[model samples]
Target: MRSGYSAAFKALLTRFAHDTSGAIALVWALASIVVVGMVGAAIDYSRTVNVKEEMAMELDGAVLAGARFLASSTDIDASKQHIVDTFTQTAALAIGDAADLKISPADVTINETEGKITATVKGQVQTAFMKVLGIETMNVSVTSQANYADKYLEIALVVDLTGSMKDPDGSGSTRIASLKTAAKALIDVLIPDETSDRVRISIIPYSQGVRLSSSDASAVTDGYSQRCVTERVGSERYTDAPYTSEFIGGGSGYMLGRTLYYMGYRLPDLIYDPEDVPEFYDRYGDGLGACPTEEVMPLTQNRKTLLDKIDAMSANGGTAGQTGIAWGWYTLSPNWNNLWPTDNEAVPYSNEETLKYMILMTDGEFNDVYKTIDITEKDCPGYYRRGCTSTTTKTWWYEHYNQTTDSSNRAKSLCTAMKASPANQGKGIAIYSVYFNPTSNAMAEATMRDCASSSRKFTYASNGQALTETFVKYAKEIQQLYLSR
Candidate 1:
């Protein structure tokens, strides 16, 4: 009996030792710890990502605000403090403050030469799950860069000084008044102050054509020898080449065979100053008064001078958009750099560092251009050697060969030339054409649209405010800021 009991007890102990249920329970307990850790880690990582995204957005706004503040504020320390304080407030509002969050004034860097501002925000997020594995926190960082580079800008304002510009549209407000206001506003925005050489502006007011000052005309002549000038001949008419003249002797300092240098000569009726029109009496009532005789202002950084020129502009001439386009291109072309003042010389066409722009405004269709026409001895009056007088006595002078089509075609050709691709004499000129005429002349609109670099570059101002708004819009675009990174 004692041997049987001993044998049964030994068998029972062997079965208990071979059992695997306890091992399975131990394995499940170990797996549970790892699973819980992974789940907590995912939750903590997601929270960190959210915080990082919020921090980045807030930091961008803070940097831009800082940059704008820096631009206006002279005190560097105050500006930097303001930037950091702004970031601190913005980030706290965006995400809960972490113990490691930090943004010092030294983190903000301003590079005036590069026209850039850089700001960085660094912080660490404490991880709940990761801390269990000996990890205390994970780093979170964001950086923002704002570029307000003062790019070298060369702007040509080709505005219509035509008599029609003086006429009040249905609104009872004159287009010329609106134009002056708009142009002055642009000048103010672009120049801001007179200290910077990064920007320069040239004014080319066009009527029957662009009026060259006596000095400019003489500059085109041989040693100031000639005064009588003619339009450009052959393919040279479409180019910005300086006018070439042959000296006709008489000590009269008269220049003949002079092709159109600066948009042929201004007509008689367009004379804004009485002192300027020596032959006003002869040409009075000749056609529609005359073209403007106002002197063109070359690229200049003087804010006062540019504003004064705009204010002094008067309305008195027929429309000649083609010549306006030509002079606009010439104003920004390096080929004609010698004609401008040394301080405002044009950069080379291949210069990628500079930007060239043309803003052409017109209130009427292009109607006048210099064309050779046959005139009889009686009508010639001998005082005029080649061109016809702006008078009814010689109606033949008014009717030049395809005057209407030719003038419009000339405008189109100039537009094409100005916007020509990288090839040819095309210098990547950005043309912005404004048609202030309220009336819908399909042909005129089409011509003006074709003149623009793109549809966005063309604007139609139905009223005075619209015109000003258009100019303000363009000013902002020309002097805009961007984010590089």
Candidate 2:
């Protein structure tokens, strides 16, 4: 009976092993655990990746902020603390409870010599499904670097002080007053410390013309008495050529006299024969009145002088934007260095260490011009018989010359020339033009737009507050921060 029981048990075991239905169920049960673990691992990995991307973006922004702070702050410890705090706060807001983020002062590295700031951020995300696979957490790390380049800057602020600037803006503040506030704000940013020589600014406040110091005016005009000067006429009209006392009328007379008399200045009785003067010699009258009272302030690191000059600005006379543009270029052109004080001389165009910029602010159309006319002996009884008769036998005379179209054309041409970089040398002058409520003058708006280095550089401010904000924006742009990695 025992032998028969053993045989029956063996036969049952054999039948169980041969059953395919139960075999398939056993294999599927074993594989399902790995499949579920893989899916869960994938989901956990995706979550960690998302958190990593968020941390990277936030860290980039934080590093940029830190670089900017470092540029302005002398205390390295404080700047590092700012970066840590900013990254921590931003990561918390971005990743929330998804991960445990870590960033400390040690993680931020600043290279003062290279003007670089680097930051590293780390985060650990606890895995849910991956925990079953013996993985408790997934670690992620990111790094970002920023470079604050130390490049010198030379800026020319050519602002319009035309009669229209006296008009009230949308905020009930006169345009001139608003401009003063805006310009000072800009100065405060660029020239934070009075002794900083890395950045220099030249202020050219213009109405119908730009005013020079009596000495500078005399130097440019060969001892002309007026402090005001206009655009040069000739091949060098659009160039920043150094002024000369040499003659332009075939060496017969001094170019100085021609430049002065052709810009509506009445020649002194001692210099020219009164009998040779034409009947309409004074037709344009004296144009010195149209010159702005605020004189041009050459490249200066003195913030007080610049602000005071802007404060002294008053508006009267038509807009002669071309003249303003010409002077603006001269202020930054190394070719005109002879006229400026030795300490304030402009850097050479071949200087790769410096950047040149021009900020042109206007609120009206360019409608003023000092148009010249050549009067020969035939036109006038003795036009050039006296003072200017030796060579050309022709005298140059000027009038207010209300030619808006020509004035606008000249302004645009000057802008083009100023924007072109010196051939095979240093960088070009970047022009930033601001038009404040120029709704009535399409020509003015168009000219300003064309003058800007790029379409994005052109700005329009509808009110005083906007104008101030625009100036601040430009100042920040000029002092830009870059992400190196």
TM-score of each: 0.64, 0.66
Off by over 4 Å in 1: 1-107, 110-116, 120-144, 169-172, 221-231, 245-283, 286-289, 373-379, 382-402, 421-427, 483-485
lDDT by residue (tens digit), candidate 1, 47-161: 7888878877888887776655543334456656777888888877777555644433327887767778888877778788876666677788888888754456778999988
Candidate 2, clashing residue pairs? none
TM-score of 2: 0.66
- Residue 144, candidate 2: C-alpha displacement in angstroms: 5.3
Task: List model 2 lDDT by residue over 1-485, tens digit each.
Answer: 99999999999999998889988999998788788889999999997888888888988988887766654445678778888988888877887753344433328988877878888877678888977778887888889988864567788999988778888877889898899999988987777655455678999988766777756765776553336667776778877778773211111111223444454432222233222443433443323235677888889878788878888888876677888898899889988898889877889888876788899999978876654456544333233345444345544434244667888888989999888857215447899998997355688789999999898888889888889999988877876777877
Off by over 4 Å in 2: 1-66, 69-108, 111-115, 119-144, 245-288, 373-401, 423-427, 483-485
Lowest summed lDDT over 10 consecutive residues: which window, candidate 2?
247-256
Candidate 1: residue 438 Cα off by (Å): 2.7
Clashes of each: 13, 0
Q: How close is candidate 1 to the true structure, as a TM-score?
A: 0.64
lDDT of each: 0.65, 0.73
